[model samples]
Target: MVSFTASAQYGKQKKADTLFNKFSFVKAAEVYKELIENKYNEDYAVRRLADCYALLRDVKNAAKYYKKAVKQDNVPIEYYYNYAQALRGVEDYKGSREWMRRYKDSGGVTSTKNFGKDGNFITSIFNAKQQYFLSKVNFNSKLSDFGAYEHNGKVYFASTRDEGVSVKRLYGWNEQPFLDVYVTEKGSKDPVDHKAKLKGDVNSIYHDGPVAITKDGTTMYFTRNDFFKNVQEKDKKGINNIKIYRATLKDSVWTDVEDLPINNSEYTTQHPALSSDGKKLYFASDRPGGFGGSDIYAVDINEDGSLGTPENLGDVINTPGAEGMPFINNEGTLFFSSDGHVGLGMLDIFATVADKDNKIIDVINLGVPVNSSKDDFSFFMGEDGLTGYIASNRSGGMGDDDIYAYNRVPLLNVEGVVTDAINKKPIANAIITLLDGNNRQIAYMETDEEGYYEINIDRDVDYNITASQKKYEDDSESFTTKNIETKVTTITKNLELNPVQDVVILAELNTIYFDFDKHNIRPDAALELDKIVNLMLNEYPGMVIRIESHTDSRGDLTYNDKLSIDRANSTYEYLISKGIDPARITEHQGFGERRLTNGCDGSVNCEESNHQLNRRTEFIVIKMK
Candidate 1:
């Protein structure tokens, strides 16, 4: 018979081995549960049980076990990190944050710099405004494929599935094969079940991927590389020397494949796209003078369809790592893929505004549903700016990369009215211009018959607006907007018409003209003052007015005073000829330019633009009653 002590030790050893062998974490957890419940090997059992729960995706239970294990035994810092992840998975964000804080305070190691900001992946994904899965793409295969373009209600992308004619073995993997390009029509239910190969002579034994099609669908641009051939040639950088090529659709087939001149030997250029108007081309390049590894660049398309010098887009859109595959809609909203920007996975798609002058504005991360803890990029939006496509390697897709369509809501709109300041009537045919804080014109729209105009503006752009008409003075106003999503904004401003006084007319300083060294009113100035005489006779039959003139400090004081008086009398004579009674008109006075509007004393050092401020004409309210 066996000894009781030997049998008890044997039983314990068998139990631990069984927990390690089952690999069925759920069952292993149950076995560990019994050990902990009976106070047998409590520390080991609790830690094992927590790891099992985490593998099972039971985050709440996982956290529970982890807390118990840490209390019983001092576990490694990684255990606490795992516990924080579990808390976050269970939507206990505050708890997760606190746990992370504690871990950091206890001197835990971190892979990245300071915690995520508002633009970071975890924050943006959780705070996304809209998100959904692209129903028909398969994401499990090992091919490196992405970059989708939407044109004329169809989606196109690069893939390396069984349908590819060319197969090249990949290194560092179990001899994985090459990839190719594929196209899918809109409203299709099954993507893989009904795949269509891109029609072209360009598909060779090499890899052909990452396509961008023009709005008219007549032109196509994509990347091509011969990794196998380059490897054989022993070219150190051959495997990554991808080049961009263009093809035209003629007779329903892509032909005449040609290399773009913009592709230089200095760097690899790929993922080319054409603007909506076909006037400019945008693409990704890792050439020298870029902000970092790779950045989106653009060039003007010549009349003969050749490219001009390419210009780097700068730090606004490009980061320190990689920025590629840019897609721009008709409204100038730019969509691109970046591994450099903060994201939830290997790569994520982002968006920003590509202004008319090619300035980048308002970079925004596309949050969850559209982006996950997987590779997602190559986005294309429709002309309507709301519906479009994306290429992702998420689960349940048709192949290594698949295309998806998304529906988006329209952004905010701004509307305002411009009117005559004096009459408060709608001003017709006024030129309304909208400028940003930098004084650059963002958009310009003309007022309709009712003097109302509307513009679709992004959420947070500061604006300065102005309206001008031929016969009236210009009116301007400035306002800054909040970052919140506002549905509509309305502003009303009245533009004042020029002077219309009676005997001695007064106008805004800018309207009246003065002689070269004298404040005496010129003949041309009298013609403008006549409008005031006409208004007095028609609106106030018995109204009288005094004309006032001012002179600069250029001449003797007495002579300057005399010149101002002569100018005012010249205005009075002109008003009387226009049927204004001399008896009803008051005499004139000269201020000799003593009181200037601007805070500058009459000095030679004052600039011409400022000196103009001192020369003016005015009429006071002497008899309003």
Candidate 2:
């Protein structure tokens, strides 16, 4: 019975590892979780489960499981590095730093390719400048909708929505219907109502679509499974690898389909993109002799319609991880999605910066809203360059992968001043944070000497801003830019922070009094004075105060003046004896028979309780650093 149980466990583990190697993380994670639930090799299952979550960019769950994996015996040192990165993604900087130190101590080789210089890199990236505004397209359904392309006067994309087929077909990877090419008019009043499957022989029973077209719309290149002529071809493992195919349009119907020369039966070559002049074709492939799992390659389109040999984009454009979904804009810039770059999520979209000789110079991440903590790919830009679309599987989407429209507009300058509520004085060195509608931090900075901050933000967004400083209550406010309409708009949002009251006032202490003309610290008076000493010594060590004593109207003016001075000295000495710094008491003085709280002057008869209020000592707060 025990031998049979071990065999069953081995079978499940083999299946999960196979899926993971094939880059099907969503399906692999399900099997790994089931193994963990059944207690089948729980330690190995825990490590793989953590890795799956990390690859999925689900940092919250990844961190949770990694915390458990690191506590297990004989764990790999690489898991230490991954756990630190996952913690950093979830904004746990302190924990991440500690685990990173442990990873280094355990002889793990460190590299900053994925995580930059230090632990502070996450904050630096999160506070990047806003360059685009993203909103979900209205036509997205509760299925896999992505790979949006625009040509002529319509938009085409790949989707798994129902198409009324007599028999429902589903893909084993995600349990969704096979992808099909769909189209809708660009400026339709109701795009969902006008949506329909493309009119052509392009789509197949298997996966199809996400096509690229030429300037004259005479040619189209699309991705499809390794199936043609009603027969599917598979690799040795029985997996149908995707391939890029070229189709020509004749009389408004797509026909004459032929596979590209770059495709191989043993590997996958998909995601076709065309240059503006139609003289070059770019695509992603997992062919041999590449830098990573898949690399971006380009081929020359000769005048006679023959293709040249494929050339890899080089190591600078690829990493040990996957890089796919190539898109070239009208200005000859290449945009691609990658998982091996220093980014905010698993798959982030990046743009290439090429030199004068057309050699790639740099790769810049297309920062937030466009690249989220999930798989974001298939970036397409219109000819105007100001409008584009991106697909993401991040939270708050209507489908597995939803399309989001993006617009590039001039940045809005948001300037603000932070001041004290009581004195209206500018508060320098105050921390300011700007957050999006979901309370995710967008930018952060410290106030300048003038208590001023200026941040450039995207238009048509709601922000929650806050200011904080030592010994002051935090101030927060919300602002929106939906009403703004201009090339350059400056929003002035001022904040007022209230100072925390002194410890004595907050403690609500009773009056500290002495015997008539004795000028000695009484037992009752010492108890109240101890409260001030404890607060200053332990809580507010930087507190600076001044001591003042006042006398009643019953004594002679000259003697009462002498008595009040002694009383102030006694209170100051008592606080110093209790371990409070003597320098904290800025000054000690007395005013005799003056500044009475009640109308108990020499001419008026007053009760003893009224006069008691006059003979009191006061602790006035001068500064709290």
Best by TM-score: 2
| Model 2, residue pairs in steric clash | none
* lDDT, each prediction: 0.64, 0.82
Q: Give TM-scores for every candidate, taking all chains together and pairing residue i with residue i.
A: 0.48, 0.61
Candidate 1 residue 60 Cα shift, in angstroms, is 19
Off by over 4 Å in 1: 1-128, 131-145, 152-154, 163-176, 189-195, 226-240, 264-266, 343-345, 354-358, 395-400, 412-625
The C-alpha stretches of model 2 lying farther than 4 A from their native spots are 11-31, 50-63, 70-121, 189-195, 410-625
lDDT of each residue in 410-440, candidate 2, tens digit only: 4687898998774566888999999989899
Candidate 1 per-residue lDDT over residues 335-354, each given as its tens digit: 78875565554457888855
Clashing pairs in 1: 137-397, 137-398, 138-397, 138-398, 421-495, 501-532
